[model samples]
Target: MAEFDLIERYFTFEYDFTQASNGSANNKSSQKNKKPKVVKGIGDDCAIFEIPEKYQLVTSTDTLVDGVHFFSDLEPELIAHKALAANVSDLAAMGAKPLAFTLSISLPEVNQDWLKSFSEGLKNASKLFKVPLVGGDTTQGPLNINITAYGSVKKGRLLERNNAEVGDDIWVTGYLGEAAAALELYDKALVQKAALNHSEAELWKALTQPIPPLKFARKLTKLSRCGLDISDGLTADLGHILSKSQCGAKVCVESLPVSEALVNFVGLEQARQYALNGGDDYQLCFTASSKHRNKILNLAERCQINVTRIGKVQDEGLQLNLNGQPFESNRVSWQHFNQ
Candidate 1:
């Protein structure tokens, strides 16, 4: 299919953002939700959208390249899903509601089957996240997918990494290390050797189709002052928070939340390594005042997300403690250039 024909067939859709009911399947009960104003979408030279009153636009972009970001032979559908999900994860980190996104993909060759599957996955993710595809470009080149996502957050409620205060309790949403374990066990032949049982398939799913805690993040905007998604592992990503806030932290190694699947497959110590340095979990890590501990816990319960208090912000430098004893490590999170 030609470029325009491919877009018209697979990407084009009519969405009335003016209607509160126009959203993804996961948020059906959010019937009274408000949508941003969109004046023009795909088919135009540029998308024109109006930001809601008192809301600031939040935008983030991510790019995934074949062979580096993922195996070249991986499913096209999974590639599409991960490409968009990574960008949406940034929105979640910012405590923003997704509005729309643009996709720019480069292909080595036109394969109808691959294109069809990729487009379907993208569309499904769009509906699932309640974000519409606004506009994008398709080109002939090495396999590459870049997505720029847009979202909105109310003024003065935006979360930032620099806002963490000393003595604040650090929290993380959801279990970690599963995606890293999945990466370790991804080779089919190594799966059995890694002791990955049938029940642990969710780890693979977590690696492929990570769901950003958007609702939980939104709720956190009101309760927590500093936060970011754990895309680069807690050890390194939390370092970002510390550097920005000009503060230090003491992470309790035993407090790291390791999924049962991971612990069963790799044992506790290895799972801890993954949680600390393996990266790609995409869960949110934030800090709030100790006074709000109960409120944050209640919010987590209401949001149906598991929030764990892993540590506390401090005055000087990052340290890892295991059962009150200092732990030593030379590990760091994933760095695109180095990896």
Candidate 2:
């Protein structure tokens, strides 16, 4: 199919740009519930958005190339879901509410079945996040999917990596390392072996369809001073926060939330390494004051997300400790250039 025709058929969805742009909705309920205004969308050369007064726009872009980001033979729907989710995860890390996104995809050939499934996944995620697909481009090339997601947060409410403070408590949302474990299984051709017990299958889902901690991150914006999504594993990504904040951290290895699936598949020690260095988990790792412990716990309870305190910010350098003794590991998280 031609590019414009392909986009029209698969990507274009009905949106009342006029009403949205004016910040006026016919539905009384919608009017009562504030939503971002999209002044102009897909048909335009550039998407125009009207940020509500006192709100700041947060934008992040992520690209996935076949063979690099995922297996080339993976399902098209999953590729679509993961491509967009990766970008959305960036927004979550910033405690922003997703607004809209643009997709740019390059394809070697037009496969109707693949496009159909991919569009379905994209639409499903857009609906789930209440973010509209605005505009993008399609070109002929090696398979690639790039998404630029936009979100909004109230002015002065945005989280930052450099805001971590000495003596702050470090926390992470949900389990980690499952995606990395899944990748290891795939890399070693042990998937079938691990899948015998369904562990590999669960990890595969975690790798392909990561759920960004959007709601939790939003709540955390109010409770925490600084944070980020753990895409590059805890050791590396947390290092980023420490580096930016000019502080160090002492992590309790026993407190790491290693998933049962990962532990069963790789055993406890190996799973710890995966949790430490395995990337793509997309959970939030953040820092807040000790005074907010009860409030943070209450917020996690209300959000139905498991938030764990794994460490404390310090003055010098990152350290991993187990039972008050130093733990040693040379593993580093995934880095595109280094890998």
Q: Estimate the TM-score of every prediction.
A: 0.92, 0.92
lDDT of 2 by residue, 202-235 (tens): 8888998998989888878888869889998899
> How many collisions per candidate?
0, 0
Clashing pairs in 2: none
Could you say which candidate leads in lDDT? Answer: 2
**TM-score, cand. 1:** 0.92
Question: Each model's C-alpha lDDT?
Answer: 0.85, 0.86
Candidate 1 residue-wise lDDT, 233-279, digit = tens = 99899999999999999999999998888888789888888888878
Model 1 clashing-pair count: 0
